[model samples]
Target: MADIEDEDEFDDLLELLMTNWRNVRQRKMPTSSGADNTAMVASTASTRKNGGAKDDRQLAEDAKVEFDMSSGDSENLPDEDEMEKKVPIPGGVDIDLNEQAAPTIRLNPKAKKVGAPRKSKTVTQAGDKSDRKWYQQAEQGRQQAGEVTLRALADALAREMPSLVDTQCRLSGVIVKFSSAESKKPKLRMLKNPVVTMDPFYLLPPKLLDACMKVLSVANTSECAIEVDGSQETRTVAKKDQVETVVIKDVGNYSRKQIENFVRIQNLKTVVQLGLELHKWLTIEGIPALPAKYHDVANQVAAQVLETYPYTQIDCLPALPDFTFSMLYRAIPPTWLSDASIRALCVRLTHDFPSCRFAGFQDAVPHKTRTRRSSAAPVSREIQDRVFQQVAEEGVECVLLPLNFHNTHWCCLVVVVSTQRIFYYDPLNQAVHLKAANAIAQHLKISGLQAYDVAAQNNPIQFDAFSCGIYVCWMFIRHVVRGPPLDMSANALPRRRFELFFYLLSGRLLTREEAEQHEAEAAEEDEKMPAPPAASNADEEEDVPLTQVAK
Candidate 1:
C-alpha cells in the first residue's frame, strides 16, 4: 500500500508541474480572442495520467503536441468578421480592412496625357462626329466679319459697329472737354507779395532758394511755387498804421498759453508796439507766474533790459515773421540760433552800448569758415575792416564776437579792445577755440590792432545738444550788463530759454527784486490756502455727502 501511494504522489506532482508550465506558455502565445487554451491544458494532463508507463520520447511527443495546439489556430478561435466587429478604432468609426481603399482624388475623365498632340472632339454641326480645328474656325470668323463675307459680316458686325464708333466719338469729346477746361481755368497766382519778393528777414529768400535749386540741378521755376497768401501778407503791413499801440495789461488774468495766443493774435503796427505788449505780458505777468525754480531768470540784467528797450531808432527791428522774437521764443525742441538773430541782436546791442562794439555773426568770420586753414591770413581784409571798423572808429572798450561752430554750436569771444584780452565762454566747457582765437589774433595783426590773449572763461557746462545757443546769448548778456550770473544748469535750460526769448521780444530784462517779491507773494498765498484733509485720498469727496464733509 505504501509503494502504490508513492507512485500516485509522484504522478500528481508531475501533472501539477506540467499544468503550471502550460499556463505560462499560453499567456505568452499570440492567440485569438475566445480561443480555448484550457483544451490543450486538459489534453496534456490526461495524456500524462493515461501514459504513466510511457517512455521519455512519448512524453516529449505529448509536450510537443500541446505546444503545436496552442501555437496553431484553435477550434474555438473567433472568425475574422467577428474580430473586426469587436476591435475599437481611435475615432469611433468602423474601418473595412478587407476591401481596397478608394483613392481620394480622381483624374479628369477627358484630360489627355502630355505627349503628341491629338485632334479635338468639338463638332462643327449638331450630332456630327467630325473634329473641329480652332485656327481654321478663328480665321473663318475673322474673314466673315470683314468685307469678304458680305451677308454674314453685315449680320455680326451690325450689332457692335455703333458701339465702337460711339466709343471713339465719346473719347474725342472727352479730350476736347479736357482741353477746353484746362484753357478756361484761371492761372494759379504766384507769390506776389512785395515782402516775399524783397526776401526781408531771409524768410523764403529767393537768392538762397535759387542757390539751393542750382546745387540740386533743378532748372524749372514753376517747381518753387511757395504759396503766400497775398491778402494776409499785404494786410499786416498795410494796416500797421491803423492798429493801436496800446499795451495790454489785462494779460495777467489769462493762463500763460492763453497769453501766448493773445500775443500771437495781436497785429502790432510796429516792433516797438510789439515790444511794449511783450514787456507787459512777459516781464510783468508771465515770468512772475512761473514756478519757483524758474524765478532765477528774473535778475538784475533783465531789469536793465526792461529800462532800455523800444529804442527811438526803427532800423533795429527784424522784418520777417520767422526772425521775429515771437517765433524765436518757442523752444520746445531748442534750435540753433540763426545768424540773422545774432546779427540783429548785435545791432541792437551796439546801439544800446556805444562804448562796447558788437560784431555781427557774418562780420566776425565768413559762414562755415574753418580756423584750420593752412594760410596765416585767417580772414580777408574786407572782413577785418568790417569787424574792427567800429573798434578803430569809435575807440570801443570791448568787442563781443559771437562765433558759430559748424552751424551746429555757438560760442562767444569777449575781446576787451583796450586791454587786448579775449575771454572765451563756451557752454560745453571745452578747451578754448584755438583756431578761432588764432584767426582773431591774425585779423588784429593784419588790421594793425593790438594782439589779444585768448583765455577760456569759467562758463556753465551745457549737458544737452541744443542749449549752446541759449548759453551764448546768456554769456553775451552777462558781459554786457555786468550782472550776477544766473542759473544755466541743465535743469534750468528751458526757463533760461524762455527768459532769453522774453528779453528779446519785450526788450525787457528781469530784476532780482521783482523775482523775489513775486516768489514771496506766491509763498504767502500758498500759506493762506487750506490743506486737504488726511482722509481725502482714502475716500472720495463724492462718496461722502457734502453736508457730512469736513470744512
Candidate 2:
C-alpha cells in the first residue's frame, strides 16, 4: 500500500515535468505564496537527485544560495510586496523566482512571422525552355503544330521509349538467388510512364523530336521500311527479327522522294496497291493500326500507312492519310475527278448558292501562319474544328465533309445542321460506313449540330472494286447541282470538267447539246495544255502512297 502511494506521487511528478517542458517557451512566472514557492523549489531539486543522502530542503537552499550569488538578475528576486499578493498553483506547485544557473532567453512572445523561405535554386530554374517568351514568338523556317505547344514534341518523344527485345536489368544493388522470384527477369517489356520533369537529360529537345517526327512520319506514310530507336536509352536497335512497331534507326534525317500530287501517276499506283491490303486488314484487325467499331478508323488507316511506309512522323494522319484518301479516291485507273481536279463539278455548277467550299491548308489553323504541324492530327481538331463554321453562319444548307476513313477510303457526309439533317454518300453502301457515319453524327454535337435526320443515297453503284469513294464524291456534286426530284440516269460519269466549270460560271446547267459542245472545247483545252512531266507507263501506274497527294 505504501509503495503504491509512492508510485502515484512519482507519476504526478513526471506529469509536472511534462507540463513544464510543454510550456517552456511560454514562460510566465505566476504569483504564489513564499512558503509554496520554497516547497516547490525543494521538490524540483530533490527530483534531480537519484538516491542522494542529503534532504531536498537542504539541497534547494544550497542551489538558491549559489544562484543568488552567481546570477546578475539576483536583485530582481520576488520582493516582500510580491510575496504578500502571490498565488500558488492549485496542484501545490510553484516556479522559483530565484535566479537559475542558466540565463533564460528573453523571447518576444508577440512577434509576427516575417515571410516563408524562398524556393530552392533547383526549383526556381525548372521551367521548360518553351515557356520562355522568345521561343513562342519564333516564327521562322520551322512551322509549329497548329495547337501543340513548343514542348509538346519533346514531351511525346520523352513518353515514347523503344520496346526491348531482351531483358537487361538497369537497376543496381539487388540480391539474386537461384530459387528466388527475383532470379527471373521480365519477359514482357513494360514501358514506364514518363515522369514530367525539367531535368535536361530527361528528354531530347523539341526541335530534335520535331525533326525526327517529320522523317518517321514520311517513312511510315510512304510505306517505306526504315529502322527507328524508340528506346531513348540505346543508340541502335539490332533488327535480326522484331515486332513491327519499334524498329531502331540512326538519329538523323533520312532521304526519300517526297510525293506532292496524285496526278503524279506513279505515286498513286503504289499507294493503291498498298491500300488494297486494307480490306484484308479490316477482316483480321491487328497490326500497326487496330480499327475500332466507329469514327476511329482514321487513326487505324494512318497507322497502316505508317507500317507500310516505315518512315512516317508519329501523327501522320493530318498530312499523310487524308491526302492519300483524297488522291486514291480521285486517281483510280480510267476514273479521275472530272478533268483531274480536286474541286467538285457541283461547285462549278452553283456557288451563288453555297456549294462545296474547299477549306485552305491554313483554314484549320486560321488567325495564324507559318505552322509546323503533324499530318496525323486528332480528327476532332483537324476535321470537325474546320467544318461548317464559315458555311453554317452564312446559313448554307449543304456541307461536304470528305471524311478520310482508315486513311484508305474517302466518304462524303452532307450535313444540313440547321435542319438537323445529314445525308451520307457511300456508293459501296457498306454497313460499316453507316455505323461510322452515326458515330460522326454524335461527335458533331460539339459543333451545335446534331444529325438526328439521316439518309443514304441509292444510285451510282460502287461495284466490287475501289470506285466507291469516287462515286460518293460525284453523288454529292450531282445532288446539290441537280437532284431531289429523281430522274435515274443510266450513266452520269462526265468525261471532262472544263465544260462543267464554264456551265457553272454561267449560273445554269448545260443542256445535252451544250454539254457535248463543252466537252469538245474542254478536250481542245487539254490538248493545248502542256502534258505532265514525261514519265514511263510503269511510274504512272505504280502503287503510290499519300506523300504525293498531301503536299
Task: Tell me the deviation in Å of residue 272 in model 2.
Answer: 18
Best by TM-score: 1
Instruction: Please write out the lDDT profile of model 1 over residues 292-410, one tens digit for every residue.
Output: 75566554424533443222222346564345443342333434566655665665566667777776552233323434555546555665676667667655777777766667677
Sliding window of 10 residues with minimal summed lDDT for model 2: 165-174
RMSD of 2: 27.6
RMSD of each: 34.5, 27.6
Q: For every model shown, what is its TM-score relative to the native structure? A: 0.37, 0.29
Q: Tell me model 2's lDDT, rounded to 2 decimals.
A: 0.41
lDDT of 1: 0.49
lDDT (10s digit) by residue, model 2, range 235-338: 56565432112111332111212111101222323344434443243333322221133225434443444333211222222343333232322332334332
Counted clashes in each candidate structure: 5, 50
Q: Judge candidate 1 at residue 332 and give its lDDT.
A: 30
- What are the Cα lDDT values of the candidates? 0.49, 0.41
The segments of candidate 2 whose C-alpha lies over 4 angstroms from its true place after superposition are 1-340, 343-379, 417-419, 483-551
